[model samples]
Target: MVEAAAPAASVVETVAETEPPATASAPAVVASPAPSAPAPVARPAAVEKPVKPKPEARLYRSRTLGQWIKRVVLLAVGAIAAAAILILAARGVTTLPGVPEFLERYPGEYHLPATAEPGFPWWAQWTHFLNFFLIVLIIRSGYQVRTQQKPPAFWTPKRGGKKISINLWLHQSLDILWLANGLIFVVLLFASGHWMRIVPTSWEVFPNALSALLQYMTLDWPVENGWVNYNSLQQLMYFLVVFIAAPLAAITGVRMSEFWPKNAKTLNRIYPVEAARALHFPTMLFFVLFILIHVFLVFSTGALRNLNHMFGGTDVVNWVGFWLFAAAIAITAAAWYAARPIVLAPIAKLFGQVSSR
Candidate 1:
């Protein structure tokens, strides 16, 4: 065994050279698995960022213009009533203080004082022409008879005065025309049945009148169908204006002629000439009163509509009649101015000094 060992020195060195190299020089560092982070707690799906709700769009509404127009019409109706009160108040303010004594002293001769000027315009002249013609014819003829100390023979304005011939002819012509016109007009209204519309259908006119009176007196209006409306009272007023007042004017007008006024005369059969003339001035006064009232009511009811009818002729419907009153007013005013006697008595008395010789 000793001999074999001794022989291996070089060979042993060769064997050692064939072995693999050692890796002890590099050290390996092991890190503990990072402490497992606490498992995330599910927070109800992150609350979805509360998606703020979008606001909703708003809607608005408006009224139609036609509805607004109805309100205007209502206001217009109210305005008419308001005007009546104002007129009555105005008349009271101006006339109350001065008229009482005048009325008491001269009931027969009393009339509304004349305006400062005479004729208003052409319209007035045409309206009042008939009245002017009739009155003048009667007055002129009467004056002629008085002057000559005999009864008037003519039924028209005599051929006398500053323009007697012209006045006489015109007066005579209008009389015939007026008669025919009146007959036709009256028959037309009555025949068409429009006149019946104004008549009260209810027998409660008196009770209705009472209630209306109370409301008027109390300054408290009661609205049923509408407020402060006219009942029988209004109907009567309408009827009187269309029937009584207008008819009286025509009837008495015819009586101005001797052909009409004489007893047993054709015209006299309808109305006595003397009686007609007697009522003439008074009837005029009544007409004036009516005119004042009618105007006031029209203004009160609805000034615009009333004026439209009075000045422009009936409503667009043209059912209502046109007002020819302006024509009459003009003639009356012009004649009144021309006929107005100068109050020269005072000056005459002062200078009547017998002209101082």
Candidate 2:
């Protein structure tokens, strides 16, 4: 029994020696990642530049009073120079071959028909005065209507239509009276057989007119016997004023006026308002030219005689006609001065309503 126990002990010891001794392994090492650089700071987006506004455009440049004066002086100088040149050239042309003979042949006039009466009648004289008054007022009001951007007073028709400036109302009113006067003059002219005086009856008038024009250019005016007969040029001018220009002015004025049918699209298209506007201004300019030329000729040729014929119904050159003319001028000047808003407003109120706007 003791020998078996000893062997068991030995076996146990041998097993313990064969087994490896218990040991602690070193702690596992882990490399931490290096600290990353701070993320780059984001830059602010580039700021956009602000845009500038555009400027308003102008139609006409402003002119000083001095500049306007300078312009007028320049125009006057140019006109004087042109007139001098024209006069010299015309005088030279008279010395050309056959010119004298031509002048002699035409003589700037032709005899009127036997039916045409001589001398100005009382009705004719009165009509002439009426024409003068009405035309002056018409021209003034027309110009005012054209240029007045801000009217002092406006007129609305009693029957209700588009409102017009007081100036325009005056212009239209004057136009009506002038038209009636013109119609009366025409009727009288025909009834008295005076149409033959202005209306050309011969083809020879053209050559005679040319001769008269040349004579006028040469500063050697044609013979004046307007009481009995007018030169070919005067006859032609009178005819144009009485027939062509007057009718044209009336037609264009009516086209532009409120009297025109607003809804008549076909007529509107056929005769556009734009066309009427264009023609109307030109006609007014023509009338103005005619007036200036007529006045100049009347005064330059024989002031007293012409004034007597038209104003006094006499062929004699006397102060009576001159005084009458002076009175007519005074009346015209008064009428012109009184054509303001203060005077026109009450008159407008009689026909319609007047307003500031």
Candidate 3:
């Protein structure tokens, strides 16, 4: 009976089942590489400044070559140009065969022939004016040489191209003007203290300048900061030109004029008229040589800019003195250049070379 009941329970057992799944699933994701950093931004070009190199040694050369021939040609051309300027300035060209007959009527004293007329653009006020005034004054003062007839030291053709009297009025007037201008300028120079800036601050200016000159001769040094800077050699040269030549010009000028009769007599005691004449001749030659050398240096350095300093303006003189002249030159752009306050000028003060006004 127990076996029959267990078998009957198993016979009714049953279980439920599910159906199959549908479509395929999507592919697995893989990440893309990270973007690279941006390329570096390019830099702009820098400002370029011209640099001048130092000078070196030189070897000797002869004058017989084609270079000499070229030099001579240039010299001749310059001479011709100078002569033409002189001729044009004069009413016309007239050469005396010897001293003109009018010379005898005037005095036994000799007169060096004048090179050019008294006035012109380049030879204006300072150079030509002073010269003419001095010459005329001397001639007038020396009108009576041996006797009451003063020896006209300056040569100007009288009635018939005879060396004659000086124009005392014109001469003195110009002299006073010159003295005033000179005194005022000297004062300005001191007050402005521009001279201090120009005076050689160091001894190195000399030898270094000579080295620079030598380099310039060999083209070893190129233009730097504009013009070739002055070395000690240039310092000495300029000092001599300003202090020596200028003073000499003034002294000789006064000696010839009637301004200081006592001084003239004093000078005459030291040197007779003929000796003075000799001195004058040599001095004139020196001046001529100075001008030539000066022009050469100007061109070699930079012409227009150097010339510009002559005037207070920029158009004529582009170079604005040499690089070494930085302390000296003052033009319109000075304030802009210095990054200074724009105001009416008091030059040396800006440089701290002079006290404030």
- Clash count for each candidate, listed in order shown: 20, 0, 21
lDDT score at residue 37, model 2, on the 0-100 scale: 92
List residue ranges in candidate 3 displaced over 4 A: 1-180, 219-229, 262-268, 271-275, 312-357
lDDT of each: 0.47, 0.91, 0.44
TM-score of each: 0.37, 0.81, 0.38
lDDT score, candidate 2:
0.91
Best TM-score goes to which candidate?
A: 2
**Off by more than 4 A, model 1:** 1-182, 213-230, 261-274, 309-357
By the TM-score metric, which is better: model 2 or model 3?
Answer: 2
Per-residue CA lDDT of model 1 for 1-357, tens digit only, reads 888887598788887889855569866567788877888877665455677888654422244566666777889888878867765654464355754454334222111123212112234223334544454444443343334432212222233222222223334445566555545545654555433434445455545555443444333432321111234455566567556765776666656643342446665565555787787557656756765765676545555544444344433323232344445456656654553113222232341221111
Q: Tens digit of lDDT per residue, candidate 2, span 160-260?
A: 99999899999999999999999999999999888888999999899999999999998999989999999999999999999999999999999989899
Among all windows of 10 consecutive residues in model 3, the one with the lowest summed lDDT is: 116-125
Give every collision pair in model 2.
none
Which consecutive 10 residues in model 2 have the weakest lDDT in total? Answer: 55-64
